[model samples]
Target: MATTPAGRHIRNPQGTGGRLRADILAAAGRILESTGSDDAVTLRAIAREAGITAPAIYAHFADRDAIRRTVIEQTFTQLATVLTTAADTEHEPVARLHVVCHAYLDFAARRPHHYRLLFERHRAARGADAGPAAPDVGSIVGADAFGVLLQAADSCIRSGASTAVDPVASATRVWVGLHGQATLQASLPWFPWPPADRLATDVVRRMADLR
Candidate 1:
């Protein structure tokens, strides 16, 4: 914990002050997670969790929705980085895609809260968009997240590996299909029994026509 000038101990061990910001984001995530990651988050509750004046949030985020966007964007960026790397070495389209899918499922399973906050939330509170000046982190990292799959899928199309290899369709297919499995696995793991890897591999093989 870092000591503030006022002799109060801060929970931020990283010393980046992002710890405070992260705490606020985390608290907001908690509210959204417990209630639903929608418009339920309030500045007062988040401020209480972060142990600071609510208005102080204005210094960092323009409003509550701004923090939501930041939190979701950061979550996607982190997912993109992880899933992108998970399939780094595999050159085969289907194999590479499977690894990426597994990486995504693993991430969602481990951080269901972040996953839900990023994709499931309807909107946020105290909300105002960060605006034109702010980076569109959604498209940015989303592109990265699926970049490997696109590259490999395109290669398969060029090589006549899959006649269905239209880039947009293929990319969208993999994304939707992968997200379905990941979402199910993360949110409702008890519905039935099948190994995630096996089921995911079967899905990818069928979709990509992998041998």
Candidate 2:
């Protein structure tokens, strides 16, 4: 729709085409978030949203999966960043974990489709990454978030936080608990839960209460 606006796509990243690529990727991200990395993320759709055409998407992405992968990868990294920052804020072992729970839920509620496209919707369901989703090459938040949970559980172990004392299991349970609340909120919004953030905070509190 908008004219190439002078040297648009032809310009390299930072050299000339800065605006075009940015616009395409952002549109792709929104499409992924809103549409669950479905068929709509096609070059044509992205281009259409960008007021361009299929050729424009090709210029930006290798193929549909590449774009989907990029969007998914970036989304997880962002989710991890939110959790890590929350974990960093508090001093108490339990409270630190609670911060992570709230942060994670906050991210989900605020970006429900992005959250769903990332974790809740199975890749098979969407027909993306057919074999399985690729593992993170060099993770940003997912691995870091797990590390924080492990560290907290380790503290729980050292401080006699619970009788059921397997650090990995404990950490996993916490993950499951928090994710359970989030998943319910995401997948079945009609089932009646508190606000997403509240449900998540409650789960986190309950997890820390383990004895």
Candidate 3:
């Protein structure tokens, strides 16, 4: 066992390589959460947080971009699971849609740093040079999360609970509103805002055209 620069004892223990990978990712996540900036998630910082040498990180991740991508993927997975569970709690189409909206808001509120990484920072990273063909947030987060939101919106339309003609368009509108709301709430927590549940419900109803 060797002591890392952070004065923490570290041990690879031969077959724990998989575990080390997970630890590296976890440490990176903590750094992102604390700093809320990708620029702060340097290899040295992650290694220090993980109690491992910077070279060891190279064994698991090719570079900082790989680590960041993995972290974003994990965050999206968590959000999708939460939204799916929230939607399952209510059987009615309209109610399920509202619940999913609340879950989305809850995720943003609970993990502001992760939310920033996923949306704000991600957009900045994609850059204007990425061109029109670059993948957007929905694609980047993948089908799991965005699919849940779209499915919920489609459910409302299929059940006649929503007056929207195009589920895709309606879902896009709902996503836009939810993102805006979450961003505003996180940036202006001191502002006088409506209750979270009430605000989320209103956004869903209006955006999804839910009856």
Candidate 4:
């Protein structure tokens, strides 16, 4: 692994071809998370962040968008892991849903940069292409992360903890609420927001109407 001047480690620095590619992606993720802006994710910035020459980045990524796409994918995968882990700890569907909701908020609060890049800035970068006609949650880039919530909502409905007639539609509503809260909280941290735990619970309870 190679350590950048910013003290972030890039794995597999001296390794073979695949390793270099992995390191490049990892480095780009670090830069994206640190900079918290799609505009800062240029190949040159990624190369500097990765502690390699600019040309080395080309070996793995075709352009800035290519690296951003990979980083977005990685971020979503990480989010899915976190949400799944949080939800798996409870047996009751209602409890699991609560945990999952809290986990989503926590992920955004803790990784504001990643959340911004994945949800906010990335969509803006896509411009008109990211309009209402975009693919459904199941086919989106971060579908797995949202899938955790969908599964939790389905389980809640099955267990009679939720009154929603359609699990997917209910899950979509809950997701919309969660995303709004997460985005607003991350964007306006200086505002005197309510207690996170209470707000998260309230959002989940109101959306699922858990019995």
Which digits, one per residue and each the tens of the lDDT, describe model 3 over residues 102-194?
Answer: 899889989999888886556434444666554554555445888888888989999999999887799889999999999998889899999
lDDT comparing candidate 2 with the true structure: 0.66
The candidate that wins on lDDT is 3
Greater lDDT among 2 and 4 belongs to: 4
Model 4 ranges off by over 4 Å: 4-15, 121-136
Which parts of model 1 are misplaced by more than 4 Å?
A: 1-23, 26-40, 122-141
Worst 10 residues of 1 by lDDT: 125-134
TM-score of every model versus the real structure: 0.74, 0.72, 0.87, 0.86
Best-to-worst order by TM-score is 3, 4, 1, 2
Clashes of 1: 0
lDDT of each: 0.69, 0.66, 0.83, 0.80
Tens-place lDDT digits, model 1, residues 25-133: 8777767677754567888877766667777777678887787777776777788788778778677766676777778778887877778776654234213353433
Model 3 spans with C-alpha error above 4 angstroms: 1-10, 121-131, 134-139
- What RMSD does each model have against the real structure? 5.4, 5.3, 3.7, 3.3
Top TM-score prediction, candidate number: 3
How are the candidates ranked when ordered by lDDT, highest leading?
3, 4, 1, 2
* Candidate 2 or 1, higher TM-score: 1
